[model samples]
Target chain A: MQYSNTIAILGANSEIGELIANKIAGNYPLLLVDQSEEKLYQLKQLVTEHHPKAQIELAVCSKDASWEADTIIIAANEAAEQASIASKIVEVTTCKTVIQIKKAHLDSATLHPMLPYSKFIAVDWANTTAIVEGKDENSLSITGEIVHMCGLKPLFKKSLI
Target chain B: MFEVFFSQVKDKVLLSEAEQKLVKTFFSPKKIRKRQYLLQEGNICRHLAFVEKGLLRSYNVDDKGIEHMIHFAWEGWWMADMLSFLSIEPSTYHIDAIEDSELLLISRPDFEEMLLKVPVMERYFRILFQNNIISKERRLISSISNSAEEKFIHLSATNPELIKRIPQQLVASYLGITPETLSRIKNKLNKNVPNT
Candidate 1:
């Protein structure tokens, strides 16, 4: 009942990020991070308009978001951009849950080295069920809780990464 | 530890010795070091705390990592993110001890039980809630309509002891102005004071 984790959604301007933000609004305090300040503000407005009591903050950079949040959701579509973000937030993301919205052939393993201490979980968001992939059981369970909070049923997949 | 709490309750409603003893059973005593957190943002506010000694503050951190002070709880005051405590949801505000503090904390269930067992507590809490709402409304109006100087003056007039106890930086944050601006205002006010 004591949900103490603050979640940061990187690439908050992305469609998936916005979807996740809307789903999780009012349940947890959010740090929405994006390169575009204007887009971040607009996304914040949309989220707050629907869930007026939602605790939402906007960040123009990933470092600021990752530093403050206990969990990080990487919603960036491109693998290259995700890699760049991973490198940038390496220090702050230690021992934190890093949830990636899986796309294409990108493996959570590729990001594992850069964020070695971080618990990585890849969420493949389906219509109603989310396929969650992770190596650590504890991290997987935490991710499941978060996915459940977002109104999605979590289907676990053990990852070799 | 319960002296401050008992006095505050007595101010609102009369309680017998038996009722006071029953009230004491519901609360647990705690001591928090300065800068220690009672409740952090994103955590559910499990307990409502009444200050016995020292000060605590509730604040919100923005995306830029700036803290915006929402409220301060001094001796005989209570602190909690009430919405989170009532709804059992994650809180947006962080409550922390601004000075080394002693507090009496009661969990939501215990609070309810105490009110039921000691029915007079309902009136006491209702009066507290009403006063809290009025204070919040006044703060909201001031933030919207008052100038920085006016805000500082009002705060000084209302809670001058608080201004002296807390750091000026925090005072500036509470007033929603820059520290330099607050310093300038203080200097200007001091200059206007007529010498004997």
Candidate 2:
């Protein structure tokens, strides 16, 4: 649903990641994490330029093993290895729910545009179907309902791991 | 296996003697030789089969004509394509006996009537569908993101009973990997295990 205070984006410099970040910049506290400091700064500039009132934070490289956020979105690269690492990052994060908006597991037709456009706005993400997997059924349902509130459809699936 | 199935069904659903007897009347015991087709493509899947003994597999032939195994239903398991069995359409999937087997089958209309007669069966099937969906989703995610080696580990960890019953190749197909890869992974696992 809505990340009340903090929202973290991994692989922030990537095109898709940046686009998603720009779209949600006005709604929540946006933190962009990328390995490239220059690119991170550029992303910040781009978001600020488009949505001047957007509250944005730039982390040059995410050295922290675990990040804390109410909600996290991983719009990283589509490489298998990258996906694996992103999964691990999600496992380690303190975030209650993690939304993975990657092309690897999903068809691009499901993408709801506007995350990269809205500024100083009520970014409603409800209507997105998130495939949720977790250790406990309660946790899985909780995460799914949160996404459901954001206008995102949540496909709750128990994880194999 | 029949004893277990009977106990499970009896314990889970409340059925009167008459309703239970009616349900049992449609069940025809069938013996299948190993590697024989239970239901083949282009044929109507007329029965909902319950595994009373041994193992069976339901598979689909891809465009390349390769058989991709969908599921292996062992003793005490139920296997069928819900869409095909519910509809009068010809089935695209094939189900075959993987081992010498025994099954109890019920026809479509009869089973539906039984469902109406035994209302508690709706709950039983609802839970069964939930469990089925959960397992399929797990397998789907493993196929999409996990590496071949990771998939083997994950599968072995999650479904040790399945690994014991189903052949390695079918397991590979379910994991979306080649048999050769499965063999290599198994070999690696064997070498890594401390003893035997």
Q: Candidate 1 chain B: worst 10 consecutive residues by lDDT?
A: B24-33
Where does the lowest 10-residue lDDT sum fall in candidate 1 chain A? A102-111
TM-score of chain B of 1: 0.98
Local distance difference test, candidate 1 = 0.84
TM, every model: 0.56, 0.51
Task: For candidate 1, write residues B75-171 as lDDT tens digits.
Answer: 9999999999999999999898888887777778778998999999999999999999998999899999999999999999988987998899999
Best by DockQ: 1
Interface RMSD of 2: 24.1
Tell me how large the interface RMSD of candidate 1 is.
12.2
- Clash count in backbone of candidate 2: 12
List the global CA lDDT of all models: 0.84, 0.65
In the range A27-98, model 1's lDDT, one tens digit per residue, is 887999988899889889999999999989888889867765768998886778888889888766644678
